[model samples]
Structures are given as structure tokens and as C-alpha cells.
Target: SSSFFGDYPDVVAFILIVIVGIFVAMGSKASTNFNSMFTIVNMAVIVIVVGYGITFADFSLWTGTDAEGRSNFFPYGVNGMLAGAASCFFAYIGFDGLATAGEEAKS
Candidate 1:
């Protein structure tokens, strides 16, 4: 059954897309129990990390070259800023997993 289960995740994601679409079309939003908790924690971590980074991180690190002799450290240049923004686009992709669950979770 491993072969069957191999494609199961995609099947499940497709099914969830359909269900969430229905809920959205009905003028309502689907809710999750841990969503608020997760959001608060996510924001708190970001604030703390950014604050700590600005306060104490080594500015010279980004100026240092990587194994490829390229400046790969974060916030390295204008290109780095844009690259960071592009990388961060995947952060919100975390939300896509919340829909691929069994109804037993709401308990």
C-alpha cells in the first residue's frame, strides 16, 4: 500500500482545497484551535529575534565572504535585502498545512 499512500498526500491536499473553498464561498472562514496561539508565538519570536539581532549581531559577518567567496550573509546588500524578501515569501506557506488534517483534531 506504500504506492497508494505515496500519492495520498496530494489527494488529501486536493480534498482540503475543495472543502475550504466551500466554507469560503458560504461567507464564513474556517477556524483552527491553535491558530491564535501559534500567531502570537510567531510574532513574539520575530520581535525578539529582530530586536536581539539589531542590538548585538555582528555587522561584519555579512561583509564576510562565504565558501564560494560570495557574500551570502543576510542583509549583505540591496540584493541581499531583496533576496531576504523573496525567501520570506515561504514563511506564510506554513498556513497551507492546517487544512490537510482529519476532523478528529478539533477535539
Candidate 2:
């Protein structure tokens, strides 16, 4: 069946599994080096994207009124912001379980 990645979901899955298996077969040092390289590339991309966004961002929009004369900042009001913050907090709350697991680890 076709998937979001395109038609050939099985082929994509097989390719990904093979790649992951290759990484697993490699020594830990090789895996760590590849992971570090990818992390650096990811951080560079993020920095570039953020820098480009900041260059064109209009800060006035944050405090100014919208075309409909509503407050631009907190367009949905403080309650909406609070609700969004709570949702995000709950979404990431699972990460705390990792800390608990770490505490229980032998090392």
C-alpha cells in the first residue's frame, strides 16, 4: 500500500532497516562518529534557518493590531497561550521517564 512517503512503503522500510542494520553492525566508535557528524549538520541547518528567519522577521507584528483590529500579540488571549504551553509541557513530560530509567540503570 502507498504511504505518506510515496508509493513503495515496503521498499522504503526495507531500505531504512538495512541502513539501520549496517549502522548496528558497525562498531560503537563508528556509530558515535557518524552520530556526531549528523548532529553537527543538524545544528548548522537550524542555525542557518533561524538566522534567515530573524533577518526578515517583523517584530512590530507582535505588538501591533491585526487587519481586523485585534491584538496581534496573543491573538487568542492569555488563556490560549496557557493552554498551548500546558499541551507542550504534557507532550514532553514523557522525557522525564528517561531520567527515572537512568536512575535505575546499573551504571
Candidate 3:
């Protein structure tokens, strides 16, 4: 199951989300505005979580590499950088949700 989570993004991931949404919708979920609140809260949570992550991290860990340092986390040269950037591409989606949130509230 864990492998399925990352193996087939289209079939496994989309189907799981659709199944969950169906269940939630059947459960009499809140008005559309409720989703706006959730969206804003989710954005805030992402910001806070990312912000807080800085505290527990060792800045040196992303820097040096040796038997003692944790810096080798991205030893794969440009590939590591590419992977990190690609993974974070989705972080840019918050603004779109914000637009939907504003529209949902205005109505």
C-alpha cells in the first residue's frame, strides 16, 4: 500500500482522493465558505510548518559532508537540486486556492 501511494500517481492517488471526497460529500460537508476557511487555514499551516522546520534543523547539515557532518543530504550534484525544486513546485499553488477562496467568500 505504501508502495502504491507513490507508484501510480494517477490511478492510485486520484482514486484515493476521489473516494475520500465522495465520502465527505456524502457526510453533509459544510458550505462552500467552509472550504475557504479550510484553504486559508491550510495555507497558514503550511507557512507555519515550514517556518517551524527551521528551528529544529541544523544549518550545517545542508552545508558540509564528512563522517561527522550531515551535509551530504544532496550529494547527487544537480540532480538533488532539480529534485528539490521539482518537489516543491506544488508550493506555488497556494495563490490559486486563495483566488478561489476570495471568490467563494464574495458570493
Candidate 4:
């Protein structure tokens, strides 16, 4: 029942964008309403992952020395922690638009 379309990048790209455009064409309220349940489910998944993942984390990976002589939980030191924090900050930036959802929602 499956056919291959790997050769058609343009078709694939167009279809992907068209599908996203359909969702974007739906006003924010409609889209937000449709996604609310999914959002709760996503949050639950995040919580579960964070809770269970810590138990499996190896304390050994946190220990190690980089090119520098200093050693700590972060092998690369404070700069590495700062860089990691910065990257995580940007990764969640897409959610900034969601903040306005409160105002966008109809009473």
C-alpha cells in the first residue's frame, strides 16, 4: 500500500509547507484550542522524562577534565555551563509566542 516519493524533494517540501500553512491559516484561537490537550500531554511527557531520566544519569559522565586543569560536574567548567544554558534558552524561544495565547483566547 506504500509508494516511494523520495525522488521528489519539491513535492515533499511543498506538501509539508502546505500542511503547516493550513494550521497557520486557522486563527490562533482555533489552533490553540485544538492543541490544548496535546500541550498537556507534552508537558506530562516532559515531566516523566525529567523524573525518570535523573535516576539513569551517570554521575561519572559529569566528572572529567577538559583541556583546562580544573575539574568539576561540568568538564568544560563554568563557560560550558553558560554555553549550555544559552543554547537551552534559545531552544525554548519558540514558546515565547505562546505567552500571548492568553490574550488571544476568547472569553
Candidate that would win on TM-score: 2
56-104: candidate 2 lDDT, tens digit per residue = 9988888988888879876888888999999999999997996697456
RMSD of each: 9.7, 4.8, 8.9, 7.0
Candidate achieving the largest lDDT: 2
Alpha-carbon lDDT, every model: 0.67, 0.80, 0.70, 0.75
1: Cα error in model 4, Å: 29
Tens digit of per-residue lDDT, candidate 3, span 1-107: 35535544477777878865765465434434456677899999999999999889887657678775435667676878898898787877787987686566531
Clashing pairs in 4: none
Model 4: per-residue Cα lDDT over 1-107, one tens digit each: 65675544787779978865676678766666657867899999999999999999877756675567567565666888899999999999978777786557563
Supply candidate 2's per-residue lDDT for 84. 97
lDDT of 2 at 8: 40
Please state the error at residue 24 of candidate 4 in Å: 6.9
- Candidate 1 regions exceeding 4 Å error are 1-34, 64-68, 72-95, 102-107
Ranking by lDDT: 2, 4, 3, 1
Error of 3 at 2 (Å): 17
**What is candidate 4's TM-score against the reference?**
0.47
Give residue 61's lDDT in candidate 4 (0 to 100): 56
Give residue 39's lDDT in candidate 4 (0 to 100): 85
